[model samples]
Target: MTVSLHTRRRQSGVTLLGLLMWAIVLGFGALIVMKVVPTIIEYSTISKAVNKIAAEGLSTVPEIRAAFDRQKDIDYGITSITSRDLDITKENDKVVIRFAYNKEVELFSPVFLLIKYQGTSRTTTR
Candidate 1:
């Protein structure tokens, strides 16, 4: 004749603390992507310029450097390295242009990210 009591199940969901933590993590990730994408694009531009100059059959170092400088002027993305920083070499009678540079990006106060970029041109036979 006694009435039975129904047991209540505990609710399961993300708490306020958990949601805040996830928001912080996602915000930090987005910040990093925003900062790093431009540098990657710049690297791609520099690589294309080097490959184009190498395939142009420029025999002299000065000519190659000047070509890169011109390309840099045209494509405003090249700032990490300059014409003087390039390592020009000849291999098997083909012009090889090599470049290496470092980019520093500031994520927050007292914290910095360093990225090293290097590339060698893909030369073509005339």
Candidate 2:
């Protein structure tokens, strides 16, 4: 009598197509993040400017705008929205300065991304 042995083989791995697909997805995500990072930095700068304006007791719209302009002049990153676009309001007699703007970034042909940013002072000076 003779004994016989049988061996089975299985294949498991990512194909070329799968690798390309993953690369595409990650590439798109990286592109979006690249565009978003600068926007986030600008927003942070704007927030700091707003907080500074409020802390300095700049209640009037003109005063706040001028303050922001000065800040923008000092820091070039705050260029998206100007003083004219600011929304100054009063809540319970406390001055509130708010601003909103949109940034358009093109990823590829006919593909664009819209980023909206808005912020207000943390606390009123008065």
Candidate 3:
């Protein structure tokens, strides 16, 4: 059977429409991911900073407080920094450092969702 050129062209017309729809869907998806990834990275940065301080082998409340306090801008891309309720106490006979923080992320249109990345970290005394 011989395929007609007209039929082939008709098939391409639908393909182009599908391609355009897909491109738009993917574009928005990329935008959402772009907004999300940075927020996640910021939270991860907070965790790393906390862990780094804990690794320093400081067992005092003042020392732990200093560690977190000193790292004000651990991540350059972090847009918002908020300190949550933190309690540095001893648990299981080990020093426990628990802190939570909130980070905000901004993105382009579609109501411009304001995402918050909240994270908690804890460390036991050495």
Candidate 4:
């Protein structure tokens, strides 16, 4: 009996079509990250602002809203929500400020991405 090594060389590596599909997928992922990062950053800024107001011992709704407005003016990243949009209330003798907003990012002509952000202040007056 003799051994034969002339079998089909076998198919290896990615084809052009496979590479293109991968590229498209990766490209879309990158685009999504690009659009989402700034929004996340802005949300973080807003959260900090809320916490600051809560910590500053602002006892009234107007005062808390005013503080947020000032913070918003200082931070350019904050745009989706405003002081007037915040929901301020008293709970258990503590001041609570809550806010929620939606951001729409236009990816293409008719395609838009919507991001919902909601947060509450950490500072609650006792």
Candidate 5:
């Protein structure tokens, strides 16, 4: 079968346009993923810390308070944390910890927006 060059060119343009559209959609998806991923990671980390204390037998607000040794950061949106001992807890009683941090992020991929991420962590003694 013989096809016209004009027809082929037109088809090419259409393919290009479709590809561009797909790129746009994917870009937005990537942007959103980036914005949300950090929150998930931060919260998970904090949660893990709480669980660690929980496994250690740190249960109760006072025990948590006593065990909580670091401020790390306040929950204002996108908080940074460095692990450290700010407080002290008993060796075998029940100990627990609770805290929150905020994450602030801006996105510009296939879309543009600013979002604030609020996350908290809690752990109890097993």
Candidate 6:
């Protein structure tokens, strides 16, 4: 009597190279998130400050800039732009505050990420 030969089933899973590649991708993603989140938070803080100052009825440009400086001093997150960087304007009897800045993040020794942030506050009565 002849015995039947059994066939081996192929394993389905990540190989060593695939696993390493995935690990590298995930690591880079984590690094970018860690670097970019703080900038986003700082931008939010700046936006809130601008909106609040615009609504506070500061008619003069100096007053608005000073208020922003005070707020920046209180909130340590605001560093990318200063009070002087603000572009204050009035439109339709409403105060508007605009700001723009650039943030450069270093990914490695030679690689960098440049982010440009710009925002304007809601028009409010001065």
Top candidate on lDDT is 6
Report how far off residue 61 is in candidate 4 (Å).
Answer: 1.2
Cα displacement (Å) at residue 42, model 3: 1.1
What lDDT does candidate 5 reach at residue 59? 49
TM-score per candidate, in order?
0.92, 0.87, 0.65, 0.90, 0.49, 0.93
- The order by descending TM-score is 6, 1, 4, 2, 3, 5
**Please, what are the lDDT tens digits per residue for candidate 1 over residues 24-63?**
9999999999999999999999999999999889999999
lDDT (10s digit) by residue, model 4, range 1-126 = 655677647779999999999999999999999988999999999999988888888888889889999999998889888899999987888778898999998887799999889998775556
lDDT of predicted model 6: 0.94
What C-alpha RMSD separates each model from the true structure? 2.2, 2.6, 4.2, 2.3, 7.5, 2.0
Q: Which regions of candidate 5 fall more than 4 Å away from where they truly are?
A: 1-14, 71-105, 108-126
Minimum summed lDDT over a 10-residue window in model 5 is located at: 69-78
Q: How displaced is residue 82 in candidate 5, in Å?
A: 13
| Higher-TM-score candidate of 3 and 4 | 4
lDDT, residue 30, model 3: 94
Candidates 1 and 6 compared: the better one by TM-score is 6
Higher-scoring candidate on TM-score, 5 or 6: 6
Pick the TM-score winner: 6
Better of 1 and 4 by lDDT: 1
Question: Roughly what TM-score does model 6 have, to 2 decimal places?
Answer: 0.93
Q: In model 4, which regions exceed 4 Å deviation?
A: 1-6, 123-125
Error of 6 at 101 (Å): 0.4
> What ordering of candidates by lDDT runs from best to worst?
6, 1, 4, 2, 3, 5
- Cand. 2 TM to true fold: 0.87
lDDT of 1: 0.92
Better of 5 and 6 by lDDT: 6
In terms of TM-score, how similar is model 5 to the real structure? 0.49
